[model samples]
Target: MQGLIISALIAIGVIVLLGMTIRIVPQRNVYVVERLGKYRTSLEAGMHILMPFIDKVAYKHSLKEIVRDVPRQSCITKDNIEVSIDGVMYLQVIDPKSASYGVDDYVMAAQQLAQTTLRSVIGKIDLDKTFEERSEINMEVVQAVDEAAQPWGVKVLRYEVADINLPASIKDAMEKQVRAERERRAVVAESEGDRQAAINRSEGDRQAAINRSEGEKQEMINISEGEKMKQINEAEGRARQIELIAQATATGLREVATAVKEDGGEEAVSLRIAEQYVSAFEKLAKESTTLLLPSNLSDVGGTVAGLQKVLKTIDRTQP
Candidate 1:
């Protein structure tokens, strides 16, 4: 009976020891087990058994993705401008054994490396580009840190730059510059509009002036043509009057010549010639001009006597 009880107690002790040695880790979790202070194999999730006294679980890390934020750090840019930068890193443990033994603190190491990498990257770019090229800088940082951390069994999944802080004075200067640029553009646009309007107005005025001038010129031309036509008509009328008077005078001269030629004696022709001479002398006397008589009083007296006889005959034939 004593031996059976001792054996039963030993069995119970062995079962308890076995129970303590078996570990059931959850999914996505890894246990870095060590044997006698030396690194053993990493224990994966679900039903991992180890030597209770010889082997110990050193560190447990989740295989799931973890996020850590890099604190804001002051950095100088390529333009010698100072700025503050912050970022976040997504990481996962690829190898729990190496993550346990490779570095003292993988989280601290990754954060420091991220900060330094961020500073170095920011230093190569201007302050304006630091914010604009944040994605590119994130890619560069992830690549660099991922490469460096490969031996440590850490995988960097993604990196993101959260914010970039500029100095208040720099922000103020940028705002002023933007405002000035807008004002300059507005003024230029306004001036261009005004100039175009003025040009249009001037063009309209020029056309109007041209039209007015053309109208005035045409009016003056019409008036000048009318005056010319009036003067031509007056001159034509005077010419016609002179032509009619000349025709009448020519007819009267023909009648006088016919009458003189039809006279039957030289005495009648002499009388007619004396009457024409007397009429011309009477017209000359009206103008008060002196005439010298010929030195033949007998011939003049004979002409007067012939004219008197022709007058007496013409009076007897009158109806």
Candidate 2:
């Protein structure tokens, strides 16, 4: 019975010793070891053995990336506006020993540093810029926090500003300003459209007037041309009629001269002349109030004889 109890105690002791000496670290995790209360070395992934009761794992750190939320804080901008800001930070531990000993708590330290850096960056710019320059502010915060966390074995990969809250009154005022600007632009655009329409109408009227004037000018030219042609035709017709009358008169006169050259033509002409003289005197007596007498009024034969003598002389002179 005593030997069995002793064996049982020894087995228990061996189990406890093995459990304390051997460690199985998971992937992406590291263990910080301390021997005799002093940091010995860091254990990587896989199995590790330590001197039992002397070497102990002091700290466990994960090498994977970490995300931390930054608490909201009030920041005053260059324009003296108070705004609330919050963000998230990405970080990773590169050195286990430094991460364990360099700072009390790296995650907390990084969060506080990020807040301070964000405020500093915000205070350098206007409130309006705070909303527009979020990326720039985030970049600045990451740079500053990463630099300060270098000794703590924390690498700040990036910082993102999650939210920026503004006053309700300011939002309302901005809305009003934007609405008024849009309305003014609309009015200007409408006026521009009207102006262009008026210009188009005027241009149309001008073109129409030009076309009408051209048509009128063409019509007048056509009318004048037609009138000119008509006048030319009438003149030509009258000239032809006058030429025919003159030719007929010439032919009649030639026939009369030929008859005068024929035998007994002189006697016929003298009798005709006497008859025309008497007819002329009778017409003169009726048309006048007073009777007009020829030089040989009492002797009509003497007048006839003088006319015959003048005719004979004209016939002798003709070729």
Best by TM-score: 2
Q: Write the per-residue lDDT of candidate 2 for residues 152-217, one digit (tens) a residue.
A: 998999999999987888778778998999999999999999999999999999999999999999
Error of 1 at 68 (Å): 0.3
Residue range 22-76, candidate 1, lDDT tens digits:
9888999998888999988887879988898898888999999999999999999
Q: What overall lDDT goes with each candidate model?
A: 0.86, 0.92
The TM-score values for the models, in the order shown, are 0.57, 0.66
- Which residue pairs show collisions in model 2? none
Model 1 misplaced stretches (Cα beyond 4 Å): 1-19, 188-319
Give per-residue lDDT, candidate 1, residue 87. 85
Top-lDDT structure, candidate number: 2
